[model samples]
Target: MSDLDSSTPLRSAVLHRDTHFIPKKAIGGKGSYIFLEDGTKFLDSTGGAAVSCLGHGHEGVQQAIKDQLDQISYCHSAFFGTNVTEELAQLLVDSTGGKLSKLFVVSSGSEAVEAALKLARQYFLELPAPQPDRTRFIARLPSYHGTTLGALGVGGHVMRRQPFEPLLAKNTSHVSPCYAYRGKKDGESDAEYVARLAAELDAEFQRVGPETVCAFIAEPVVGAALGCVPAVPGYFPAMKAVCKKYGALFILDEIMSGMGRCGTLHAWEQEDVVPDIQTIGKGLGGGYAPVSGILINDFIVETLDKGTGMFRHGQTYQGHPISCAAALAVQKVIKEESLLENVRNMGAYLEQQLRQHLGDHPYVGDIRGKGLFWGIEFVKDKTTKEPFDTKTRLSSLIQEKALQPEYAISLYGNPGTMDGVRGDHVILAPPYIVSKEEIDIIVDVTVKVLDEVFKGL
Candidate 1:
C-alpha cells in the first residue's frame, strides 16, 4: 500500500441503489434533454420518473427558490404560515374551482397520503353523523399509495406489500383496479364493466358493513403499478356514487397524473367527478423543490373547521416556505404558458409517433395512455395477452438499454406490470415542453431497444 504502488477501486463511496445498473452522473439539463459527465446527451423522455414537468434548469423556478432563501427558508408551521405557502394553497384550491377549499402541504407523495388518511379518520370524528365504527379502508389491488406505514398499509401493490403483509393494516382491504385492458371480461361492455366493478365495491362495503368503511381510495388514472392506465368512461362517477351511498370518502391519488401532466389541469377533470380528498406530488414543484400536498373538498374542510379546528397530523417540513415558493412559481408558469393545451396537442402527436414506430412490433402487447403520458407493455403471447415472467427482467433490460449513452433516452418507471411482479411495461411521461424531434428520438430508441432485448430473450 505504498504511494508508488497505489491503485484505485472500481467504485466510489456513495451507496448506490441496485434497482438498475450503475447510473451515470447527469451534469446538467435544459429543456427536454440532459447532459451526462461524459458529454452524452439524453432526450430525458420520462422527465426523471415524471417529476420534472417544466423540464430542467428552469430560470423562473430557480429564482423563486432563491427569493425564498433571501427572506426566510425554514419556519415551523406550528408558529406561522409563510406567505409563499399561503398563496400556493390558495392557488391549488382555486384551481379546483373552489370545490377543494382547503390545502395541506407536505414534503412528498407518501407524506401527503399519510396526511389524507389521518384527515379522513378525523373527518369522521367531526362528521354531523358520527360513526366511530368507521375504520375500514378499501383500496384497489395493484395500486400504490406510498411507502410509509399507514400509506403502505392502504396500498395494495402485491410485490411491494408482500414483505410487509404482517405489518399492514388489517382494517384495510383491496378490491379490483379499473384495469379494463386485463380486468374487463371479453363479453362485458364498458357499462357492464363499470357496473360490475361498482358492484364489487358495494359488496366489499357490505361485507365490512358500510358503516365500518371510512374511505375508498384510488388513482384517477392509475400510474406506475398499472402503467398509465385510465379508467373507462363513467367509472369515476359510479365509484363516487358508491362512496356517497355508503358514506365513505373518495380519495384520489394523483401523485403521478395531476398538475397538468395530462391534458386537463387534473386527471380527475376528465373523470366527471371530484374526490372528497386528493393527493398530488411529482409534478407539483416540477422537480424544482421537494414538495407535495393534499386537497380537501368543501365538505371535509367545513367539517374540520367547525369541530376539531386543527389537523391532528403534522410533519417537521410541513409547508416549508422555500418549497412553496418553487411550487407557486411553477404553477404561474403553467398558466402563463398555457401548457395544458400544449399537453393535449403534443400528446396526440406523441401517440402518432408511437403507433408509427412501435405499433407493429411482434412482442408489443399494448400501447395506450393519454395526454403527455403513455405506457408500452410487453408480452410472451400477444394473442393470449400473457406477460413475460418477472424473473425474465425483460422491462428492466429494455430500460437499461434505452438509458445507455448510445441510446440517450431516459424512460419513466419500469414497473412490474403483473400484480407488481410478473409483468413488463415502461412508462413514458416526457415533459410537456418536449418537441417533435425529441418525441421521435424517444420512440426510436424504445423501439430499437425492445427489438434488441426481445431477440436476446
Candidate 2:
C-alpha cells in the first residue's frame, strides 16, 4: 500500500455499502424526521430499517440510558448479573404469556440468531436421548436472517449467499416463501394456497430426512428480502403443524416485524401460533441502543435446565445494562401509551392512503403487509405481474428520487422479490408516533417520487 500524503484530499473514512456512494450525514432528528448536516429535513417514513419504533429524541428513553450509565453500564454475562438485565428478561418472559419463558440477550439481531441456532442444537443434544444428527436447518427462499456466517448460511437470499457459498455451512436448505402476490396460482383460493405451501414444507422435511433437521426458521412476515409480505390466513399455523409432525423446532426471526412493528406485539400473535424459539431486534431498544435477543419456549428451557444445567453459549456484552435499561424504557412507553392500538389504527389509515393513491398506478403491482409495515412492489406490466429487469434498478431510482430536495422523504428499497434477483419493492414503516398529517405527507411524497421515476418508462 502506498503511503497517503496530507496534501491529497481524502475520501470518507467510514465504509458504507458502496465506498464511492457516500451519503449525506444526518446530524439531528426529532419524532418522524431526520435533519441532514446541510439542514435538509427528511420525513423518516422507513424509521431506519424499521428500528426507530419510538422515533427520535424521547426524553424518557434518554433518561433511562443516562440512569443506567450512572449506575453500571457493563458486566460480563458469565461473571455477574445486573438488575436492569434481570428486569428486562422478566418483562420479555411475561410478554410471551409464559409460552417463551427464557431470554438470552445479545448485541444485535445476527448475534441473537446465532444464539438461537446454537440453542436449538444444544437442546437436541441435551435431550433425554441425544440427537447429534439433528444439525440441519430449513428456512424459506428470499428470506433474510442476518449477516453473520451461520445466520447467512441459514438464510435463503440467493444473491447474498452466492459469493459466500463455499464459506457458508451446507446443512441449511430452503423452501418457498409464502408470497401470495406471485406464488399463488391464478384462481387459487387462500385456503388452497396455504395448503399447497404446507405440503411443500412437509415434502422438504421428508427429502432432508426429518430426524436430522433441528429447526425450520422464517420471519413471520418476510422483511427486507420480500418487502414485508405477511402470510395468508392459516399459513403460519399450518407450517408450524408440519414442524410439529417432524419434531423440528419452529424458529421465527422477527428482527424487523416484531416488537409491535406489526399491529400485535409479536407477529405470530396474529398468526395463532407461538414459536419454539424467537429472535427479535430493531425495535427492541428503539434504535437508542444496540440490543437483540432470543426468547426460548418453556419446554426448551426445561430441557436445558434438566440436562446440561447451563447454556453453552455466551457473549461478553450479553445483556449490557445500558441496553436493557433503554429497552425497558421503550417497552414501558409502548405499554403505557398503548402504542400497539395506535399501530393498528394508524396502520389502517396508512393502508387506505396507499391504496387510494397508488392502487390505480400502472407500475404498482402489489400492495401488501400488516400494521405499520407495508410494501409496494413495482412491475413492468401490471396485467402480467412482470417484474422490472434487475439492471433497471427501479426501486433504487425511486428511493434516490424520494430523498431529493423536492420530495424530502425517506423510504426502504428492496430488490429481488420475484426470485433472488428479479423484482423490486419499497417498504414504508413509519414510526408508531406518526400522525395523520405525517401519513398524508408520506403518501403524497411517495406518489410524486414514483411518478417522476416512471414518468417515461
Candidate 3:
C-alpha cells in the first residue's frame, strides 16, 4: 500500500475524515490566517467551510468564553438556564425582527438540523387537529443537511446517502434544486425557470402525498453539495407557496449560508419568503466554540405552546454556557465592527476580481454566489458545460495544490457539482474581515493553482 493509503494505519489514534492522508496540525491562528505545527502560515480563504466569520484569536470572543468558564461551564439545559444562553437566544430572535420567536440551541450544525427535523415533526403533531400522518419530509437534490440519520435522510446528497440507504428513513423525498446555471433550460427566462422549479416541487408534493409531508427543507443559498448555488429569483416564495398549499412547514437550513456569511445576517433576508423553521450555525460562534440552533416562527411556537407546551427534544449540551457566551461575543463583534457591511463591500470586490481574472478561462463554466460566499465550477468543455470526469479528481487536485507551501492557502473543494458523481467546484468564503488585498491574493493564487492543475489536462 502507498504511504498515503489508509490500509497502512497511521500513528495517530483519531479516526480522521480521510485516514489516508493526515492533515496538517493547526497550532494557532489570528485574523485570516492559520499557522501549522511546522511553522507554515496558510491563508484561510474558505474560513474552514465558512465557519470562522470573524477570523481567529479575537480577544472579545475569547474573553467571553473565559468569563463564562469562570462562572460555569456545564449545566443541564432542562433544569437550569444560563444568563448568557438566554441573552444569546434573545439576540438571535431579535435579529429576525421577532418573526422567529424561539431558539433551541445545540452544539453543531448537524444537531441543529436534527432538532429542526424533530421539531418540524412535532409541530405538525402539536397542531389544532394534529397530523400524526405527516411523517415525511421533502428536500432538494444535490443538497446536504447533516450527517445524522434523520438529517441525512432528508438531505439529497447521493454519495452521502448511498452507504446509509437502507438505514435512512423511507419517508423523505427529493426534488430538483433551483440551480439556475445548469437546471435552467436554454431558452427559459429566470421567471420561467423559477415557475418550472415550483411546478416540479408541487408535483413532488403530490407524488409523495403532500398530506404526509411535515416540512420542505432547503438552504436559501445551497452550500457544500452544490457549491454555493443560490436559487433563481422568486424561487423561495414559489416553493413556500407550494408548501403552504400543502399545509406543510417550510424549513431553511442556513448552517453554511446564514449568520452574515451572505451579506445579510439571515440569508432569507435576501429572499422574499420566510422559513417556518431556520437552522443556523458555523458563523454563529465564529469557530470560537461549537454552537448551532433552530429559530422557530411565531406560528409554530404558538401552536406548540397551545398544545404540548414542550418541544420534546433534549441534548446534554443544549444551550451550553460557554458556547452561548462565545456566540454572543461573536455576534457583538460583528455588530460593533460593522462586519456585514465589510462582507458586502469585500464580497463585491472579490466577485469582481474573480470574474475579471477567471471568468473567461476556458475551463471555468460558472461563477456564482452572494456576499462573501462564492464558487467556481470547472468544466472540461465550456461550450457544452461538460464537467471533468470524476476520475480526474480535479477538485482534490486544486485543493492539494492550493495548500502547498508555495501557495500557502486554504480552499473548500468538492466533486459532484453536476450530479452525485461528476463535476468539480471550489468555494471561496473568506472571513468578513478579509481585505481587498487579501481577496486579490486569493484570486491570484486561485488562478495559479487552477492553471497549474488544468495545463496538463
Candidate 4:
C-alpha cells in the first residue's frame, strides 16, 4: 500500500477541504491513533479539531450505540420521546447542578447555536413586557460560534465571514475579546485588563441600545480564531455583569471547550459564572455520534412556560436516540474513569513541557490553554510579538510537516490568531486519557517538526 499521490486526481466524489491536496484514506482508528490505508499509523493529537475526546474505537461507546439501536434507532423528538434522550438530558441538567433547568438537544453544534439564538429572541418576546425591539446580539471579535447563517453572522472570524458578509444578518455586533496575550497592554494588571474588556462590552451594549440586544455570546476560551486563549481571572463575571446591566441574556458557546475538555464538566465552571444560555458539542459525544445541545436557565424556561408554552424551533433529528445514547455512554465513561482528574494532571505537564522545549525558540511567541486544550502561537519576532506574513503559510507548513511520514502526528493549525487576518498558531488537544509518556512523545515530535519547519528561517 502507498499513500494517495497528490499528482493523481482524487477518485472519490467527496468535497474535501482542499481539492488538490488529496489525503490518505483512513482505514481504521483505535485508542488515539488512526491507520491509513497505506498501513501507516498517526497519533491523533488534536483529536480531529478537539472532537474525539474519548479517542478512537471506544468499546464501551460502541456497545452503547449498538444497544440503543436494538431498542430504537429513529424517533423524531416532535412526535415522540425516547428513554435514552430523556436520560441524556437529565444527566446534562444534573451535571449543571440544576442551574440550567431545560435542555434542547440538537444534531450538531451549529444547530445548537442556531437554536440558542432563536430561543434567546423568543425568551424576550415571551416576557410580560414584550421586547419587540430587542433584536440584536453582541458577540466577541476573533471568535467562532458555528457555520450556519445565524451562527456565522454572530461569529467574528474575519476569513470565514468575508465572503458571506453580504448575506449575514446585520443585527449582531462585535466587541473586543478578553485576549490577554496581545490585547493586554504592558504593565497592565490582570484586573485592569478585565476591567477594560468589561468596559468595552458595556459600551457595545449602549452603542446598540441596551434594550435592543437579545443576548451576548462568546466562547469561554476563544477557539479557532485566536486559538485556545482562556480569559484571565474575573473576566467572565465582569462580562456577565455587563450583559445583566443591559437586560440581555448571556450565552456561552462551549462547542470546543466544554464537556470536560477544560478539566470541568462545563468550562464556565472554572470561570466562576453561570451563563443564561449555553451551547456545547465536540467532546460532548466524543465523536461517537453527531450530537449537541443548549442548556437554558430558569429565567428563559419560566418566561416561555408562562407565555408560549413551547419553543418555536424544531428539527427532524432533534434528539436522535442513538446519538443521545452514544453521548450518554461517552459521558459515563468519562465519569467512571475519572478522566477529568487526568486532564488536570496531564494538562499541567503538557504546558510545562511545551514551555521547556519551545520557550526559547525565536518564533514561539506565546503558549496558552487550560486542561488538555492548548495552543502554541508563532511570531516572526518574539520580542516584538510580530506575526509572520499571512502569505508565508507558516501554520500550514508546520501542520503538513507534522503529518509527514517522519513524524506521523496530527495537529490543528489555523491562521488569524492575532486578529481575523494575520496570525498563526497550532493547537494540540490530545485525549483526556493521554498518559505522561504519550505527552512526552507528543511534545518531542512537535518540537522536531517545528525545528524542521523553521530550521533555515
Name the best candidate (by TM-score): 4
Question: Which 10-residue window in model 2 sums to the lowest lDDT?
Answer: 1-10
lDDT of 3 by residue, 268-361 (tens): 9986478999999999998899999999999988998999899899999999999999999999999999999999999999999999999999
Q: Which stretches of model 1 miss by more than 4 angstroms?
A: 1-13, 19-22, 413-415
What lDDT is reached at residue 274 by model 3? 80
Off by over 4 Å in 4: 1-6
lDDT of 1 by residue, 1-457 (tens): 0111114333545555652234578889999888887788878888877889999989988988998999999989999888999999999999999988888999899999999998988899987778789888999988889898899899888788889888877989999999887899999999999999999999999988999988999988788888888899999999999999988999999999899988888889886588999999998999998999999999888898898688888989999999999999999998999998888988999999988888878887788888998988888888898888777878778877787777888665455686777787889999988787778778878888777778898
Q: Regarding TM-score, does 1 or 3 come out ahead? A: 3
What are the candidates' C-alpha RMSDs?
A: 3.3, 3.0, 1.7, 1.3
* Model 3 error, position 349 (Å): 0.4
TM-score order of candidates, top first: 4, 3, 2, 1
Q: What is residue 446's positional error in candidate 2, in angstroms?
A: 0.3
Question: What's each prediction's TM-score?
Answer: 0.96, 0.97, 0.98, 0.98
Q: Count clashing residue pairs per candidate.
A: 0, 0, 0, 0
Runs in model 2 lying further than 4 Å from the true structure: 1-10
Q: Which candidate, 3 or 4, would have the higher TM-score against the true structure? A: 4
Residue-wise lDDT of candidate 2 within 1-457, one digit each (tens)?
A: 1122345454668766654456777888899988887678878899989999999989999999999999988988888999999899999889989889988999899999999999999999999999999999999999999999999999999888889999999999999999998899999999999999999999999998999999999998898999999999999999999999989999999999999999998999986599999999998999999999999999999998899799998888998999999999999999999999999999999999999999999999999999999999999899999999888888888887887867888779888888988999999999989999999999999998898899846
